[model samples]
Target: MSRIAELTSLLMPHLMLAPIGLPMLTAALLLTMKEEQQRLKLGLNILSTLLGLLVAVALLLWSHESGAPATMGVYLPGNWPAPFGIVLVLDRLSAMMLLLTGFVALCSIVFAGARWHRAGVHYHTLFQLQLMGLGGAFLTGDLFNLFVFFEILLAASYGLLLHGAGRTRVQAGLHYIAINLAASSLFLIGASMLYGITGTLNMADLAQAIPQVSAADRGLLHSAAAILATAFLIKAAVWPLNFWLVPAYSAATAPVGALFALMTKVGIYTLLRLWTLMFSSEAGPSSLFGSLWLIGGGMVTMAFGAIGMMASQRLTHLAGHAAVLSSGTLLAAAGFGQNALTAGLLYYLPSSTLAVSALFLLADLIDRWRNDGASLAPYELDDVAPFLTPELMPTTGLNLDEDEEVLVGRVIPAAAAFLGLAYMACTLVIAGLPPLSGFIGKFAMLTALVNPLGLGSSAGTQPGLPGWTLIALMIATGLLALLALTRSGIRHFWAAHDRPTPQLRVMEGLPIAILLGACVALTLQANGVMRFTEATANGLHAPGTYVRAVMTAAPIPGPTTTPTPERAESSATTKAAP
Candidate 1:
């Protein structure tokens, strides 16, 4: 075991590249295969996705190891020093996100294999490309690479959204493509402005430079940050900029929608990472920049999502709005900038994502059950009966012989039972009910808010009006979600009596089970998870650690060379003559 550990440590630097490299290689290999070779493609996709998940788990464990001198691992693809070559940093946050991406991708691909993968050409290839892009986005340590990966993912999503193309999907895909293109432009402009101001696009270098930037450039710097934030916020589905999210997400197929649950988090993750690194207390006169805006924007977004959830009639649309609500909560908590609150938000992130993803999958199954064989036959207008006619009046009671006994209850089918239980679990987590991870997470954040001083510290100042407002909003939104989901549940499960039972495949059902099971495990292990999150949050607030790790990471040394005797003699003669 010790020998294996030593070998792993030796290979750790190279292994950091696997998350991105493995998917790229797999996609390229998949592309070479013929369209009829779906079985092989499916097997390959599953194998690659599973391997990626294992790698992510290993990295996550490595990052969390207490004995390590530094938790962040820096890999230079080109063997050049920081700010000169491409770099990938594996830290707690990135590791967690990588694990999450892998888990969701595995589930999505498995679900897709049941049917959705065959919906169009290159589905597996596009899926792998999307994974590669997401992995790259999380691991990259610079702005240019971030933009590159963003485009990669966005391009892949365009094809995925339009897969099994229909009028609705085509329309939604066009809008999705157009909005993201604008966001990309904004992203490029913001990155360029920052590069012009700081003279480097490396995140750590930017952090170091921000403190020393000239006063004259400060305005420009903030403006660039704002523009960059606008792009991220749109991706995060913040209010007023989130008009594209529901239509796009709801229009997607089940597996794709489940995978897309992580898309918005990318935006939130970037905001959390950059805000702390570049605008923390160390940045004089720029400490906590845009904090108020985040708070205000987040509150408004929560309200909007709540209202949307209540208004939406479709289950898919309801899930989309729920995602928006989760984003709002995360954004607002980030704005608080408290270590405890940040820890709680980190804990909440995965819980909410898993629940929302499960809801998306579940929505599809429920819709099929409700609509299958339940469509009414069309009739001519002349055949319609008059409502006022007594003979055609609706009857309230069943007609039966007086001696017949009514059956008390009928046994529910296995499929219906599974759907009901899964739906109930999703509802509990999404609505932040007690005895689940979501509730625990919200409770932790609420505790942090009421205390206002650091967790376990002596009492100090209380949270301000913004904090109070966020608290109220959280409670209110959770209630609204509960109401909306309950209404949806009744309409789908109880209101209709003649709907046929859905015949669910193992691939379709197992993923939802696994996701909800994870939420259960999270609840059971909340203490350990919260501790990890607190450590991660602490590391995030300390910018110096990240900067030092990145800036001091040395490139791999070149091959050693031995000087020839002739060269040595020539050098000696030249030295003597001089």
Candidate 2:
């Protein structure tokens, strides 16, 4: 082979590992660095993120070109068979998630470089570890490994959430940690139950074994699945189970909050992956299991989110609830089980995630400006409204050399105008207003809900009351969001007392622009994106492809069975099956 061709061939098999491995290695190196080496840390962080983004993009493109779910890369570490060893599978869904994670992390890290990273020790290390955990979770091919990755990311997140120690953040972090620990325990119990029942921790093996589960044990399996789903739902910020999300997210510093926009989606992503693969139409009695629960829980979550959004006065709280809204919407759509609805949801997911992240960062900047002007003097009982003033400026200790610049005559208006316009763009995207990718996503969902068949096909059956309810909820949620954001925008930008325009650096502002720019690109390429998602949805409906790919690609011991001779023979036959 030619040298270039040989080199490509040599490295091609390991491409799937690059995204997960690079961040982990970077994080380990970062842990050894002194906190004072800001420049070195920042440079390494950016370089690592840039490389990860490139790898994720390459994986996405490769998966798109692969043309079949079975062809998507499945990397088994140590060259062991899939069910017997850890595997990293990269289908369109995983690849897309990887890309989104990389893109969002890149933007958040870059934005943080302007200030947030310096807020605490080992921020960059924790950030990279977070990426590693997310990537691993997305790519893993088994439930046991999923739990492992979840713990890794949650540990990193606990640190990141408390990065800048303060009363609010510390308190919120404690609650967040406590809740997730409980969830983790539930996760362990559920995984153990599943292993006890099916004798497999590999997701693909579980899919194969679940169908064969006896009627007598199906209820137990269902209970185990419920336990697992509950854990995921809590992480997804579903109603009642998600009380910790808003306070924790709102208390987090801006960049961490922005990166966290993807965390809830990770829960949604796991639900979609496991449910479709193991409990879809082909899973016999377990087919479409718990779907009603998904739909009902999702609707209630949306209702809660809408009410919260309307009531929220703070921007961070609004962003947190908006994320909840997105999660609820996706879960409901996933419950519908129609490929068309899922396709629309696939398009909607990334668009909404990007918008929420942008909103988090933007809200922080605006809040800084608004709160900076508050009175800093100690309260006196004799003074009226003694509790309403800020005891200290929001930027009390931060270096503000950039903000200290005095803009001459016309420059102030121009700067203010830029920030206002950016804020408006984010508002439009979040509220699903005209002409942006968010609108396209919601419009697609609505169209899919009305016509569970592909758009423009009259033969498609009309949806029932549930669909209509979802449609109404979607519309009402958007209206509520628009009103809430519009009111907040007016008060902050127009009615509030004029303060120094938030000092935004190029580094800080560029990340927002890039994210918004991605949204615009999604709008421009809506047709192509939708087409890809349609294919993805179809792949999701066909669980056999995923299972067969994992099982047949490498020989592994068959799922555990009874120790009787007949059962042993049966297991051998299954393991020997082509």
Q: Model 1 TM-score? A: 0.91
TM-score for each candidate, following the candidate numbering? 0.91, 0.89
Candidate 2 lDDT over residue span 159-257, tens digit each: 999876766777889999999999999999999999999999999899999999999999999999999988999999999998999999998878999
What would the per-residue lDDT of candidate 1 be over residues 144-197, giving only the tens digit for each residue? 999999999999999998876666777888999999999999999999999999
Q: In model 1, what are the clashing residue pairs, if there are any?
A: none
Give the number of the best model, judged by lDDT. Answer: 1
Give the Cα lDDT of each candidate.
0.85, 0.83
Off by over 4 Å in 2: 1-10, 373-397, 400-413, 454-463, 555-578
Pairs clashing in candidate 2?
none
